[model samples]
Target: MSMFGAVDLSSFAPKQGSTPAEPAAGAAHNGRPGGLVVDVDAQNLREIAEGSARVPVVVVMHSSRAQASVDLVDLLERLVVEYAGSFQLARVDVDAAPEVAQALQVTAVPTVVALIAGQPVPMFQGSAPEEQLRALLDQLLEVAARNGVDGRLDLDAAAHMAEPTEPEETEVERQAREAIERGDWTAAEKVYEHAIAQSPADDDLKAARDQIRMLARMDGQDPVALLAAADAPGADLDTQLAGADAALAQGDVNACLGRALEAVRAHTGEERERARLRLLELFTIIGTTAPEVARARRQLATILY
Candidate 1:
């Protein structure tokens, strides 16, 4: 079994009537390993071989005409970026490079091969997730290290593989947005949470999530109900705070401000602090245009003085 489901050997061998040829410049799977991508054709044949000779290269061959193949290519690109610091990714259009395709014995529209030292080794065809691909890469690296090629290529592989994974992040964000657009608030929330969990420190994901949160607040909840519940006469600090939080969650900035101020007026230090922090978050969400932001800055200066 391969990292992606079960491995199918049908895609490994060359197609019928295809003859194996000696590795040549611009030849499918022919370029020298242990170096940067040099031959355009060869480079194209192997998705990523240069700078990753010791790490093994995953050549993703796809037909541009096939929708599934095209999608697989895009996913592969995302995986390349995600594992940029670990492996090299190169693409060969089977339709464009027919001989190379024939040489690789590709019978399918999308085939992915792991090549080490200029030889095709374990391969998986079809679309595989990034996690699965990474797993295979880890296994390949371990095997290579055991084979004595890791030490010489470790640094080079690391350097060659470090590409931005933001594209993947963006794709995730887009899917979340689409979910929200489809009125699937729970699904959207889950996706957004996943994105945040995966990258808690990511400012972009954080910002995008803030937008989603705002949208979620406007969906079914009634802002007035929350505010009234929080402000009912003689409400305890905790109850009021919960109500204020609900208001904030419903995108009711004014209600949050009023409830927070009421809590402060009652001499509730803890509630005051919570409201203050929530105010800061509100400003962050609403951006810098709020007059309260400037007032807050001046008040900070006065307090420091």
Candidate 2:
């Protein structure tokens, strides 16, 4: 059985001519190495899946006509470059690779699945918020770690080609980095907070503050313990909150958000308000623009009013 559930895609095979001719060397977008992102069809699907023994392979089933599909492809491509080859992305056009889609049982245009040691682990369907996707990828890495599939691609060439020169860091940014290095999150937070207060309109400063706050919340905490406590019978709201914080620190955005939302539904009066307010704060940490936040925001409204 696949990690997500039982999935039998072994019988499906890509029809001939459905596969595109292999691209010449350096023909991929931005001259990315072939190992980073590869178009997969029935012919090479098994080979790529088996290669997951070395590194996690993210299979993205997409359609050309859907704007959401296009957006997801772009996001995955960006993440591929950002992750520097922690995993390989297998881009499968559903229309052209129906057998592959059938094998995966994809019911949506943008279904993502992870492969490790050739076993499929379903990830998500449709367009997921960027932050949520990042969290999911982090979890995927953890999964890879457990399975001994730890391999990193050399991204120096790609990074050099994509990154542009930047100005020297400001003194405040320098102080923040220094404080972070010394494990003084409070000092780091204060630096970013002060910078934000001075600028008042700098989104970058606000983002930095948010990141530092999340770091502080999870600092010196054991995530496994927190999660265990949160799941214990008769666990209190504070314990769950701690679990949520630890989850956020570990880049499990869904777990973080879900815990708070559950608290909101379970508590009442001041307790409910506390959960609601905390949820709002998490939304800020995750950025209000994320689709998960948007969905959670709507759900919050329904709970409150």
- Listed in order, each prediction's TM-score against the native is 0.36, 0.54
**Candidate 1, 128-224: lDDT as tens digits:** 6767766776776665444433423233443454354554546786788789789987787687678779878876566556656555655565655
Please report the candidate that would top lDDT against the real structure.
2
Model 1 worst lDDT window (10 residues): 31-40
TM-score of 1: 0.36
Off by over 4 Å in 1: 1-52, 151-305
**Model 2 deviation from the true structure expressed as Cα RMSD, one decimal place:** 11.9
Q: Which residue pairs collide, candidate 1?
A: 14-105, 47-89, 47-90, 48-90, 84-161, 84-162, 85-161, 85-162
CA shift of 9, model 1, Å: 15
